[model samples]
Target: MFNRRKFIKTGAASASLLLLDKQSFAEILPRQKTGKEQFPIVISTWDFGVYANKEAWKTLSKGGRALDAIEAGARVPEELDITNGTVGRTGTPDRDGHVTLDSCIMDEFGNCGSVAAMENIAHPISVARMVMERTPHVMLVGEGATQFAVEQGMKKEKLLTPKAEKAWKEWLKTAKYSPVMNVENGTNRPGGKYNHDTIGMLAIDAKGNISGGCTTSGMAFKMHGRVGDSPIIGAGLYVDNEVGGATSTGVGEEVIRNVGSFLVVELMRQGLSPEEACKEAVMRIIKKKPENAEKVQVGFLAINKKGEYGAYAIQKGFSYAVCNAEKQDLLISGKSYY
Candidate 1:
C-alpha cells in the first residue's frame, strides 16, 4: 500500500503551492524610473528643521556622505539652548520630572542603531551611530545606553535646565496630561515659537546614497519610562538606498501602530510618488482609528531615491524643511487628512 512515487509527486506539488502563497504576499514592485535625480539634498520635519537643514547642508554641499550630513543636522537641534522643551536636554520632562531622550540613525546600507529612554547624554543620536558601527546590536536603552555613552567619553551633565524644571513645577500643579495636537506649531506652549516634538532628517548625497535620523525628547509629561517611536526603525525612521528614506513626527504611537516610515518607502517602491505614498500611509492610520485620529497629530516626510520629497499629516499645521543646492531653507506645509 506504500506508493512512494505518488507520495513524492504530491509532496512536491504541495511545496510549490506553499512557495507561491508566500511570494504572493511578499511581492515587491519593480523599481521604476522617476524624474531627474537631485544629488546632495536634505529634508527634515518641522520648521526648526530649517536650522538643522542648514547645518546638514554644510556637509552635503561639500559632497560629504549622507550619513555624516544627517548626523550633523540632527546635532543642531540637540545642541540648541532654546528648543522649547521639544528636543534635547531642554525637552519637557516626563510625569516624574525626568528628562529622558530617544534617537535613531540609519545609513545607506540598511544599518541602523537606536537609543531609547536614555538620560544625561546630550546627543543620543551619536550614541545610536556608535551602536550601529561598534556593537552588534540595533538598540540600547535606559541605564545601559547611558553607561555606553560614558564609556565612549561622553560627559554626563544635568539635563534638567532651570527653565525646564520651572515648567515641570508648573505642570505638577495640575498634573493633567494629554498630548496637544500640533504642539510643534506653538499651539499649546506657554510662551515660545519653537515649541515642538521631534526632528527627523533624511538626506541623499552625491553618490546617490540615502540615510535618515530621528531624535526626540518624546511627549511632554509622558510616563517616566515611556519610549515612543522616535528610536524605533520603520516607525519613526527608515532608509533604503535602493528605494528611499522616510521619517515621521507628531504622535509616535500612531506612527508605530502603522509602521509609518517603512510603509511610505514600500509604497514608493510600488511606483507611487513620495507625496502619494505619504498620503496613503496617513490614510491608513486615519482609517484604523477614525475617532482617535481626530485628537492626535501624526505626520510623515518621505524622499525617494530620485530626490523627490513630500509629506502628509493627520492634522493641519504640519510642515517640513527642504535644503538643496538651489534653496537652503525652504519650508513646505504638508497636506493633511483633517
Candidate 2:
C-alpha cells in the first residue's frame, strides 16, 4: 500500500490571522448574519499544527496582531515536551550529540530574521523575531546565533532532554542514515522520526498584514553544523504584504535547492491559485530530480493577502490545520503527487 495514489482532492480555503503585542481581534474575514467568514485565518504544516493553531487562535480570538499570533503558534512545538523531540528543548541532537535549532520569522514589512545551527536555547522563533526587531541583521548562526540569543536575555539551558540523550546514544550504535516517512504521526522506525515534521504557520490580521514563522530541530542524525531550509528566508518560509505568505516542510534540501517557498509566493503573484502554486513547486523539484522525487517528501502551505490558502506535497499523509472565525479546529489532508 505504499504510495497508493498521486492526487487526492480535498476542500480548499484561504487562511491567516493577525496578532500583535496589545492587539485585539477584529472582523477580518467576510461575514454575514449567517454567512461563512473566510478571513483571519491560520494554517500550518502537519497534524501538530492543530495544537499550535489553537494557541494562535487564542490571540486572534481576542483580536491580537498577526505576527504575534504566528510567533505564539511557532513556539508551541518548540516549548512542548515530547518524546519525538521535533523542536526546541527535547529535539534530537546532531551526530556530534548537540541539540541545535533552526527558525525564521517574517512580517508584513520586508523585515525578516533567522537563526541556524543554534544550540542550548529554546524558542528560536522568539529569538528570530527579536533579531528582526532589535538588530539590522536578518540572520545569526552557530555560536554567534547562540551568543545573540543569550545577549537578548534568552535562557541558556540544555536542549537535549534525557530521552533525547538516550536516543542519541542508541543511534550512535547504528550511525546509519536512512530517512523515513510518516514518522511524525507516531511510528517506530529507523532513518528519522523527530525530523518528520515542522511548524510552518501563516497568519493575516484585520488590517490585511501577513506574517509567517517556521521552526524545527532539523533532520535527525544530521551532520554537525548543518543548517536546513527551515531557517532560510526564501526556502523554508516567505512573506509579502502585497501578495501573500508561504511556508514549507519535509525535505529541506529539496526545498532549499529549489527555493520552494519563494517560488510559491511568486506564483501567487503571477495569478496562480495557492493550490496550483504549491503543486507547481512540487513538480519543479521532481523535474530536477526525478529519480529521488518519490524517495523524500516536501510540502508547501500558503496563504494569500486575500486570505486564500492551499497546500501540496510530494507524498501522501501530508496534512495541515486551518482555523478562523467561521471554524475553530479543522484538519485537511492535501493532495499529493507521489
Candidate 3:
C-alpha cells in the first residue's frame, strides 16, 4: 500500500527546509542593487575654461565613448575662438601672427599619442588620433605633423585667422623692452607666463573604461615653433584603468616640469585618493626650486569607478564639468591653478 500521508509530510518538510536555505543564502550574500553600476564621466575647465554648455555631455549620455566626448568638447573652444595660447583659431599668435596647435590622446589601454607645435589643422586632437591609429610612433611635431595630417586626408587651410592676427598685432604694440623680449635670450616671452595653451578632458565610460585628452593652440607669441606640454604624454593626458584618468590645463611648461598627469596617477596607485593625488601634485609645483616659482598655474581633474571624483589646482580658481547618468554640473572648486 502507498503511504501517502508519510510521503506528503516528508515532502512538506523538505520544501520548508529548501525555502529556509534560500532565505539564509540571500541574507549572507551582498545586496549590491544599491551599488553604482555604470561609471561617471567628468570634463572640466579652469576659470577661463568653459563648461556651462551641456552639448558635450549630451553626446556622452547618448552612448558616445570618452574619445568622442573629448574631441567634441575640445572642438567647442577651438571653434568658439577661446584661449589664445595654444591650438585654436584665436590662440595668441607669434610675432608673425601664425598660430600653432598642440594636442594629445590617451586610450583605455594606456597607449598615448600627441602632436606639438603643429600648424594649419583646426582639429589637432583628431589628427593625434590618426597618429595613434596609423603610426607606431608616440608623437609627431611641426611641419611633420602637418604633413601627416595632410596625408591622412585631413583638410588643409590657412593656419591663421583674422582674430589671431589681431591678437598678435595687439601684443606687439604693447611690447615692453626687457630681456624677456630679446630673441637671443632663452626666454623670449614665447607666450606670456600668464598665457595658457591647454585644455584637458578626462572621461569614464559606463563600462568603467577611462580615457583622457588635451588640446591647445600652442603658447601665444611662441618662437614661431615652440612646443609646450599640451602634446607631452604624461604632462597633458594620462589614463590607467587601475587608477583613473587625468588631464591637465594651464601653462604647459609648468605642467611638463612637474610631470603633472603621471605624478597624479602614480599617487593614486599608491592608495591616495584622486583628490589627494591632484592636490599633492599641485602642491609639489608650489614647492619647486627658486623658492616662489612663477605662479605656475595648473588644473587637474579625475574620477575613480567608486564615483569618487577629485580636482585641484595651483591657481586662485578652478572649475570642472561632470556628467553622470543622472546629471551634469560644472564643479567650480578652490581658488586658482597654483
Task: Estimate every model's Cα lDDT from 0 to 1.
Answer: 0.81, 0.79, 0.62
Error of 3 at 47 (Å): 5.8
Worst 10 residues of 3 by lDDT: 6-15
Per-residue error (Å), model 3, residue 177: 9.7
| Residue pairs with clashing backbones, model 1 | none
Task: Give the poorly placed runs of model 3, Cα more than 4 Å off.
Answer: 1-38, 47-53, 81-87, 174-195, 335-338
Candidate 3, 32-62: lDDT as tens digits: 1223335545555532233412445666677
Pick by lDDT: which candidate is best? 1
* Candidate 1 TM-score versus the reference: 0.87
- Alpha carbon lDDT of residue 165, candidate 1? 77
RMSD in Å for candidate 1, one decimal?
15.8
- Judged by whole-model lDDT over C-alpha atoms, candidate 2 comes out at 0.79
| Model 2: how far residue 266 lies from native, Å | 0.4
TM-score, predicted candidate 2 vs. hidden true structure: 0.87
